[model samples]
Target chain A: MNLAFRDIRHNLGRFVLTCFGLSLLLGVVLSMIGIYRGLVEDALTLARSPQADIWVVESDSRGPFAESSRIPGDTREAIARLYGVSAAGAITYQSVETKYGAKKLRLYVVGYELDRLGGPDKIVAGRSIVRSHYEMVADRRSDLSLGDRVPLGRNMFTVVGLTENRVASSGDPVVYLSLRDSQELQFELAPPAARREMARDEGVPGINTVNTVIARVSPNVEPDLVAKAARQWKHLAAMTQMEQEIILTRSVVERARKQIGLFTAILLTVSTVIIALIIYTMTMDKLREIATLKLIGAPDHTIIGLIIQQALAMGTIGFAFGALFISSVKDYFPRRVILQPDDGLALAVAVLLVCILASALGVRLALKVDPGEALKG
Target chain B: MSLNGSHTLVEARGISKYFGEGDARVDALREVSLKVYPGQVVGLLGPSGSGKTTLLNVFGCIVEPNTGWMSLDGEVVYDEGWLRSDLRRLRLEKIGFIFQFHNLLPFLNCVDNVAIVLSLAGFSTTQAKQRSVELLEYLEVEHRKDAFPAQLSGGEAQRVAIARALANRPRIILADEPTAALDSARAGIVMDLLRKVAIDQNAAILAVTHDEKIYDRFDRIFHLRDGYLDIEQERGVTEMTQD
Candidate 1:
C-alpha cells in the first residue's frame, strides 16, 4: 500500500503546506548563494573586461581595484617601448555619485587614452565616444540614454554609447571616458581647492597621474616574462592578467564570499533542525497508529520507511520549489544573480542528505513505541 | 464442555507475570492456565485491574510470562522465554489481535486497513487486497471498503478491524475489550460477528471484556480476579452442563 504515500495523500493539504513553507526557507538560502556568486562576478567584471596581458601600477600598491595606485600617465609610453610590449594604455579609475533625474546614480568612472585597449568591448546601443573631452560610454544599468549630459565635478559629459553588465566591484555601473577627461576629473583639484593652493604659494598638482598602465605582450612573448621585467623598475609594480583577477577575488571580494558561505552553512543547519522538528512532530502525531501497526506484526522497517520517506519527500519537493523560484526571479534582483546548474545539483544532494539525517529523530521515536499501547483503552 | 478430540489452537500452562520490584512490586498474573480449541469462542471476564488484559497479552505473545510455557497451533512458542527469535514474525503468522477501540489506521481506507496485515505477512498486494475484499464482504462491511476509519460509523470501524484480524487466517485471535466502546445493541452485534467468525473459520477466539450482556455469546467463560482464574466458576459450569 506504500503507507508513507498513503498518509501524505490522506493529509494532502497539510503536507503541501509544509513543503511550501520549507521551500520558502530553501529559496532564501539559494538566493543568498547566487548573490554571492554575483558579487564575485561583478567584482571581476571590469578586471576581466580590459583583457590586458600585464598590469603596471605604482610600487607597493595592489590597485587599481583593491587599493589606490597613482603613476604618471606617461608611464604608458615607457611600457609601450619595453621589449615584448605590443601596446600599453594608461587608465584612471574613480567612483562618482551624481544626480540622474531625481535619483542619485553611482558610477565607476574609467579614463583611457583614445584608441586604447582599456575600453568597453561590447557597445549594445548608440556609438562609442567620438569626441575626447565630453563624450562617455555608460553601462546600461546607469539608466543613462544617448546624449544625456551628466555633470561630474567640473564638467558635463554626454553619453555617447551604452554597455551591458559592466559594473565595478562595489556594484556601481561603469562609464568610460578619454584619458585626458578622466585624469582631469579624477586628479585635477576643484576650482576652490586650486585657488586655496595658489594663495598658499604651492603649485597646483598635475592632473597627469593614472591609477594603472595596462600592457599587452607580443604574440610570441610570455606575459609573465614582460610583467617580471616591469617589476624590476623600483617605481613600478606589474602583474599578469591572472594575478590581477586573483587579487580582485582574494582581496576585493573575499569578506563578502566568506559572509555568504557562513550564511549558507547556517541556513542549511537551520533547515536540518526544522526538518527534524517537523518529522518528530509528525511521528508523535501518529504514535497510536504506529503502535497499532506494530501490534499487527508489521516489520520494523515498514514503520521506519514511513518516516524516512516522508522526510525525503519533503526535502525533494522543497528543493524543487526553491530552485524554480530562484531561477525565475534572478534577473529582477538589484544585483546580477547567477544560478549555476552545478550549484543547484549540489544543493539538491545536500537537501537529500540533510533529510536523511533529520529523519533519524523520528525513526528513533517510532522504534521506541510499544506495541502493547494498542491494547489500552 | 470437555475437550476430547478437537485440536487445541492456544494453550498456556502456569503463566505468571509481574510488574516493578521490591516494595513497589505487583503481580499482574499468577499461575494462569487455560486451553482453547478450534471453533470455540471463549471469554475472559474480570473487573478493572484483575489481570484479564494481562493474560490476553501473554497469550498474544505481546508480553513475556515470568514462568510458563505457551503453545499456538501445536507449536511450543514460549517456555518462560520466547522460543522463537523473531517474535514479531511468529505473531504475524500465528496470532491476530483486536483492540478495545477499532484501532484502524486513520490514513488507510477500510480495505487497506484489512489488507496491510496480509501485506506484512508477504502476500502480494493483489492477493492481499482480494482477501481483504472477501473478508470485508464476509463481515458485511464491504460497502464501506473505500471509506477511511474516521468516515465510518463505530460498528463499521469495528467490522473493518475484525476483517483486518482475520486477514492472515490465523489459528488464534486475541481481543482485548473488543466491545467496550459500543452501545448495547452494537456490542451484541460485534460479539455475534466474532462468534460467527470463529465457527466459520474454525479459529479459536479469546476475548477479554467486562461487558456482561454478551456472556451468552461465549461458548465458555472464565472469571479472573486478583490475577488468578476462579476455579469454582469452571467447576460450577461443568456441573451445570452435566445436569
Candidate 2:
C-alpha cells in the first residue's frame, strides 16, 4: 500500500484545498504563457499575411509594423523594373475608428493592390475584395458580418469577406481594401486643412503615397540579394521576408513578451515557494509519525519516497486542474490567450521539476527527525 | 516457531552508558546486564528517570552503550561500545518494539500497520498481508483489522500493536511502558495479550512498565533505581481493577 496516498486520503479536505490553491497559481502561469504566444501570433498576423519576399520602405525605417515607413506610390513601378523582381505592389496601413450604427468600431485598415500578396491569408466567410471600390475583407474579431456597411472618411464600404486571427498586434481587427481607396482615405487632408493649404498656396504633394512597397523575387533569385538591390536607392530602406518577420516579432511584441515572461517567472517562483512551504508544513505535521516509522525499522528511503510522491501528485493534479480551467476560459479573455498543447506540456514538466526541488526541503527535515523522539511520545 | 525455552535469545553484559562528559557527566546505566530466554516475558519496572528506558534502548539497538558485549540469537551484534552488524536490519528481522503509545500509523488500517514490518523485511505484499491478518486473528483483533488506529479503542490498538510486533516472528520484543496509556482493565488485557504472544510465538518479551495492576503477568521482573538494575526475587499479587 502507498503510504503517501493513504495519508492524503486520510486528510482529503486539506489536500483538496491545497490542490485548489495550487491550481489557481498554475492557471495564472498558463494564462501568461498563452497570452505571450497569442501576442506573438497577433504581431505576426499582418507581417505573415503578405507573402511578398521583400519589403521596400522609406530609408531608416524598420518596416510598417515596428516603424512608420512611407514610400512614393511610384516606388512599386521602380521595384517591378528591378532585374529579379517578379511581382511588386504598393500597400499602406492605418488605424481608423468609424461610427457603425450606435457602436464605434476601431479597425486596422490595410490597402493592398489587387495583384499584390497583402490580402487576408484565409477567408472564413463571403469572398475576398471582389469589387475594387467599396468592398472590404475584415477580421471576424471586428464583429462585422458580410454585406454590413461601414462608413470610412467620405464613403460607405460593405464588408465582403471575413477571416480569423487576422487582427493587428494591438488586437485591433483588420480591414482590407483597395490600395488606391485606402491611400485616399488615409492620406487625403481634411476639408478644413485642405482649405488652409490652398489659401497658403501649398500643394498636397504626398496624397498619392503608400506606406510600403512589397516585392516578390523570381524563383531562382535570392530575396536577400534582391532586397540589397532595392536598398541601393538612397530614398528607401529594404527588408527581406526574414528581416521583416524578425523586426515585427522582436520589436512589435517585445514588451508584451517580456511582461508576460516576467509575470510567468514571478508566478513560477511563487508556486515553488508555496509548494515548499506547504510540503514543509505537511512534513512537520507528520514528524511524530515519521519518527515512529524510523524507530520501527522503516528505512530512510521509504520516508523520503512518501514525501516525494505526495509532492509530485499534488503538482500533477494542480497542472491538470489549471490546464482544464484555463482552457475553458481562454476565449473570455479580452486579448487572445491561445493555450497550445506544447506549452502546457512544457509547463507541466517545469512544475514537476519544481515539485521535486520543493519536496527536498521536506525530505531533508524528515531525515533529520530523531527516531528516539518517538520512544518518548 | 522452533524456540527451545532453554536457549538465551539476547544477552547484554556489563553495559555501561553515560551522558555528557567530565564534570557534567551522568551515568545512565552502570554495568547493567541481563539475559532473556525464549517463550518468556520479562518486565522492567522503574520510576521515571530511573534508566529503565535507557537500558531498553540499549538492548533494542537504538543506541550503543559506552561499553558492552551484546548478543542476539547466539550472534554478537555489538561489542566494545560499537555495533558489529546492521542494527536496523537486526531490529527489523530479530527484535520488535512496542512503545508507550501504540504508534500504529494512523493512515494505515490495523492490518497494514501490522503488515508493514513484514513488508519491509522483504516479504511480498500478498504474503506479508496474509501473515499480518492471521496474526491479528490470533491476537483477537481480526475484526478490527480494517480499522485505522484512531478508530480502535485503547485495548484494540494495543492488540494490533502486539500483532505488528509479532508479524515477523522476531526472537526478541522490547516494549517501553506499553500499558501506561491504558486503564487498569485495558492494561491487564494488553499484558495478557503480550504474554500470550510470547508463549504462542516462542519469543522473548521485555517490557518496561509502572502499572501495579499488571505485575503478575511477567515470567520474570527486574526493577531499576538510580541507574542500577536488580532482579526482583519475590513480589505480591494484587487484583487488577476492570472497567
Best by DockQ: 1
Considering the two chains of model 1, state its CAPRI-style docking category.
medium
Query: For residues A120-204, what per-residue lDDT tens digits would candidate 1 score against the true structure?
Result: 8889999888788999999988889998999987889999999999999899999999999998888889899999999999989
Model 2 CAPRI quality: medium
Tens-place lDDT digits, model 2, residues A1-377? 68999999999999999999999999999999999999998888788777889989999999788889888988989999998898888999999999999999999999988857677778989988877898899888888999999999999999989998788999999999998889989988888988898889996546779899888889999898888888899999999888988997788889879988998999999999999999999999999899888877888889999999999999999999999999999988878898988999999999999999999999999999977777886
Q: What RMSD does each model have against the real structure?
A: 2.3, 4.0
Model 2: clashing residue pairs? none
Q: How close is candidate 2 to the true structure, as a TM-score?
A: 0.93
Candidate 2 residues B74-161, lDDT tens each? 7787788554545677788888889888888899999899999988898999999999989988988899988999999888888898
Chain B: TM-scores of all predictions? 0.93, 0.91
- Lowest summed-lDDT stretch of 10 residues in model 1 chain B? B234-243
Which pairs clash in model 1? none
Off by over 4 Å in 2: A98-104, A154-156, B1-5, B21-24, B234-243
Native contact share for candidate 2: 0.51
